[model samples]
Target: MRDAETVTFGGSALNRAAELRARPDEIAALLNDPAARAVPLWRGKPSIDGAGALGWVAANHPVLRDGEEPAIFLGSDETGPLFTIDLSAWQPETGADPVPASFFDATEQRHPGLPDGHRFAELRNIMADLSARDAECAATAKALIGWHRSHRFCSACGEESGVAQAGWQRVCGACGAVHFPRTDPVVIMLITRGNSALLGRSPGWPEGMYSCLAGFMEPGETMEAAVRREVMEETRVRVGAVRYLASQPWPYPSSLMLGAVGEALDETIILDPNELEAARWVSREDMARAFAGDHPEIRAPRRGAIAGFILRNWLADRLD
Candidate 1:
């Protein structure tokens, strides 16, 4: 596989086995199979061990007993069929609760039922350390479970929806409306002109941390167009000749980040205060220092994010 394809939360090529979603009996039997294992999540955080590997427990493990919903069928591998169970209902100790509305949550929650090192850790904190297969599985589990939590009611009719297809879908009993998981597409572009790259920081991001500008794709807009539009709207930077580089399944509430590079037509930056707290152009040399943790006023983008992936590739001339 190309280096670009190995971005975190992608390129695992796991057999999703979508056909099996409709087979309820087969899925039920697989749940009982001794070889089947499940990854558990507590309030959107997955269990990770001290070694940074995702912790898996047998499907019938006591830690999974309290989830209000059925286990989500991820896919099959040589080990057997894989599943994920949501334990959001499992609350932690009083002081260990997650901070509300924080940009980064460093709190770790350990269930009494789980082993000592198997604590539910924030995905972003451990994302760079997970194996490709573990990253894919964790992303899939987080996205699917989050979708279910937010979409419990049918939009067509104000009726509560029920889990169906082993968590792949929701069925509205009142209106008979069937719904599938939604993935919002966001374009994150590394816009460049000459030796400098345009980078921006959002309001709540940590100080001195800047990354490629990104925004959600509007309806009926193409990826290239989204890239141009977002940059222009946020920084008034006109972008031309956009090209796709890579993609990552960012499951912080389920977004597929479309990574791209755009040539900047001008060096002028007019920042919209509402969209960006600050914006600047950094030369290749300064960016290298940021990545190496040597820059005094600038910090590197979050590790395992597509922004960092694309920027690193651009710096190495490996975006191909």
Candidate 2:
């Protein structure tokens, strides 16, 4: 766990500029600054350049226009200021990344200023490849954008909400209600009793691809309690001595992954069909092989994931 913060999208330490975001004029000033930069998203996919890095455009890039309301202020870096603009409405001329045919609104969008080979890449596909700072910025923007899309209406009064607080909040002009973005808490546990740890796969995951037992923490539930409950509910393996290990920001629509290590009191796993498709214990040596891509039957959790982080640390005896 020496380099625990290196976990993908775990802790990039972006400044966020909370005070600057509170000033209406500063927000506008930053947006208009010549040195300011912006990241573009089409159908929620990030723009990537030929170098396989985030393709940040100048604030004045033609793809950015003033008419777009709710332009999210993503805070400033050493490069002056930053923002994000959703270009989903703009149609591409040619040679753009095609929206997945399965998408509800299928179309391709490519910005003219972007290099010929530059295109929108889904974060999930490129997260592991991105530098820690780039990954954190992109994930933060994605989560904020998604929140704006889904929470445009006031939850309390059922009225429309206007973007406020430099893209961090929505204000209902009608009822004067203010709402903030939410981050769902999930507990992903590495439960071990002896030399083996427990892993489980949901119904639709690829065959042999399993991860730590994880679930959303319910109301009034402590993190430790959530871990124990999720383990027992899914596999009937009673867990003890649950404690925090590390955390990751899983920005797939904004969920915080709270990694934990738990001691299993009983190794007998009685799977609950509703919670998991399959659950079992895997020996440490075999798990190590899985991490090295040589396991005969089990596949390691995806790299950069908290599951992988916890498993690797456990294998290395670093979870003390």
* Among all candidates shown, the one with the greatest lDDT: 1
Q: Residue-wise lDDT of candidate 2 within 185-249, one digit each (tens)?
A: 99999999899999999986777898999999999999999998899899889988988888889
Any residue pairs clashing in model 1, and if so which?
none
Residue lDDT tens for model 1, 1-320: 15877889975888889999999999999999999999999889999976879988899898798888999999988888899999999879899999758998999988989877899889999999999889999999999999999999999998999999988999999999999999999999999999999999989989899999999999999999999999999999899899988888999899999989999999899999999999999999999999999999999988999998888888988877
Off by over 4 Å in 2: 66-68, 91-109
lDDT of 2: 0.84
- The alpha-carbon lDDT assigned to residue 166 of candidate 1 equals 83
Regions of model 1 farther than 4 Å from truth: none
lDDT score of residue 27 within candidate 2 = 89
| Cα deviation of 79, candidate 2, in Å | 1.8
Q: Could you tell me the lDDT of residue 114 within candidate 2? A: 67
Clashes of each: 0, 0
- The candidate 1 region of ten consecutive residues with least summed lDDT is 1-10
